[model samples]
Every structure is written in C-alpha cells, then in structure tokens.
Target: MDSQSAQLPIKIARIGSTVMNDFLKIPVRTEETSATALPRGAAITISGSWKGSITISSSDELSRRIAAAMFRKDDNSVEARDIADALSELTNIIAGNIKAILPGPSQLSLPMTLETVPEAAQGAVRVQLQDDQAGQLLICVQPGLH
Candidate 1:
C-alpha cells in the first residue's frame, strides 16, 4: 500500500466494507483491501451524498476487460447500451441502501462514467475491495460542497 491510501478515515472504511458485505456479499480483509496498484491501475471514485471514495484496482488488465465486456452490449444478444444502463441502475440501488445507514438527508446522484484518464486520481478517501473481479461501490460525502 502507498502513503495516501494508508491515511483513509475509519468511517469511510467502515462504510465501504459494509457496502461490499451487505450489498455485494463480498468479504474482504481490511489490510489487503486498502492496497492499490502504482501505475496502470484502476481507481473509481463515486462522490455525492454518502461521502467517501472506493477504489478497486488490479495490475491485471484481463479483469477490467472482462468487466467491460460483461457490462457492454453485443450484436448477438444484449445491447451494449442496455448493459451500461443496467450497471448505472445497480449503482443507484447500492447507493440508496448505503444512504439508509448514514445520518442526515443526503441524496445520491445516478452513477456516471468516470471516463478514461491518463492516470487515476487520488480521491478524498480510498476504499479498495477484497475481490479484484468485483466492481467497487464508492459514495464520498462532500458535505455542503454542493
């Protein structure tokens, strides 16, 4: 793990773990969960009401590719647009579930594409999941920053 990831707040960590456990049913080791790859890694940040960013990264490109493919539409069967839409819907459901646990009236915006950047950016708080094959769930609260 790097210095930045090590400094994540406990509250966010707890929320991340809870999201994975309750929503995704994925159990992870907290120590290993926070470790992120250096370069050519994937870090996703979902910032909105329930504040904290969660990153799921791996050195393996195959994993990411598979995830992309599975979530995309093909000519033979499902439409690529539909797959993308489904993923966004799933993100909303998970975020709503997480919001129920938090204190206050914060709403989650629908999950949008993070886009491909030259390098992954450092988010407010880092949340790395247990399974690399598993997509991440992050909801970073910015308070009254809106």
Candidate 2:
C-alpha cells in the first residue's frame, strides 16, 4: 500500500453511529461479530487519488424503520421505493463524508440499492453494528483502487 492509499482511514462505528443517529435518530452499538449480508442493502464506490467503496446491509426491520423515519410514517406504511431511497441516501451521505477528506480528486458514485450484497471483494473490511430498535447493520469498506 502506498502513502496515498493509506488515507483509506475509516472509523466505521463512529461514522455509522453519527450518520444513523443524525439521519434516522437511531443510535447504534458495535458488535464483535461481523454483520451478515442482508436481504436489503445499498452500496457505493469512490475512485481517484484515493479509492474504495462502502456497502451497508441491514435487517428488514431496520430497513422499514429507516424508511419510516424518512417518510414520517409507520414502518409498515412505508413503500419499497421509500425504503430503497432511504438506504441510498444514507449510503451517499456516509460515502460523501469519506470522499471529502480523502486525497482527491475523488469521484463518489451514486448509491445503488441491492437485494443482497455480492461477495466481498479482496481487501474488504467489514464492521457490524447493532441498534436497540432495529437489530444489526453491516458496513463493508474496501480501501484501495483495486
């Protein structure tokens, strides 16, 4: 790894907590075990002087809660598109913060909603988090152009 790629510095738990707390008003705690690939999720990629990607996967309940929070409605009342939009926005916010501090000129791609996370690429870092109301959410960060 070169010095530039070393900027792949990440604080997954802190980032997750702040983003989730601020965006959804839901606090999260980190767990020792990594979170599994969830049925509902989102992923984004960034490339340039410093390159990497972040993938977020969550429990169905959490998905609903997130959508509910965004739409100001009950979890069951939220539509699938609402849930997808919420996840996409959350992923973008988290990735944008990361891209900002990195050795640019970095281009952060649009967030992509996923039915399930694909296999982890080589050199990926996965962090698991648990929320009191929503259960577990996973953050997988890949820290290099590769």
Candidate 3:
C-alpha cells in the first residue's frame, strides 16, 4: 500500500468535515455504521504516484439537507437531481483537497455521480460520518489503479 492509502481515513475525515461544513453548513464527524441509504453519490478516481477512488454514500435525508442548504431552499423542495449535484460538489471539494496532498503527478478525475458504488469499490476502506443534527454520510476509498 502507498503511504497515502495508509493515512486515507484521517485525511478523508478531515477533508470531509471541512467540505461539508463549508458547503452544507453542517458539522460532520467520523462514526461507525453499516446502514446506509440506497442510491449513493459520486466516484472520483485518483492516479499517478498513488491510485484509487473516493465515493460518498449518503442517506436520502442527508442528501436533501445538503441540497437544500446548497441552493438555499427548503429540504422538502429539494429535487433528486439537485441532491445528486450537491453530492457531486461535495465529492469534488473533498477529492480536490485529497489530490492536493498526494505525491505529485497524482491526477484526480472529474467527479462521476453514482447511485451505487461498483462491486469492486464495495470492499474499499470507508470513513463514515455522522451529523448529529441530521443524517449520515459515508466516504469509501478504494485503493488501486483504476
């Protein structure tokens, strides 16, 4: 495993906390749980000095809340596509930060919003976050060249 992979959990947690807080205006903290809502979020591939991908799987409630905050709308009025876009934006910010810290020549692909992570990524290391005031969001980091 590359050095970056070894420290992925901490890096992801820090990145996620900052990104979600900034964009969604919510506090995000690491927590453990196997339960996640159906239909996840985005996939961002990493290459060069280290290779892998990051995926954010979030609960429906969490998605709507984020979307609502991002667009300055009520949660009940948030659209499905907007929720996906919010997830994409969140993934982009966190992934961008992660890419910046990796050994150079490292390249980050554009965010690909996904309803479900591919089977291969199901086995990846994950960092789960809890928003005490809202729902859950999980960040999965698959280690390997894609």
What is the per-residue lDDT of model 3 for residues 91-124, given as tens digits with 9 covering 90 to 100? Answer: 8888788778766778888899895655444547
Model 2 regions more than 4 Å off: 1-10, 144-146
**Per-prediction TM-score:** 0.43, 0.85, 0.84
Off by over 4 Å in 1: 1-83, 117-123, 132-144
Of 1 and 2, the candidate ahead on TM-score is 2
Tens digits of per-residue lDDT for model 1, 1-146: 56534543454557656654565444543443544442222222234444543233323332333234445523245443544444444445545554555553655554663333133244444444444444433334222332
Q: Candidate 3, overall lDDT?
A: 0.79
Q: Write the per-residue lDDT of candidate 2 for residues 35-131, one digit (tens) a residue.
A: 5677788989888887878888888888888888878898778998998999898888877876676668978888999987875777876777788
What lDDT is reached at residue 67 by model 1? 34
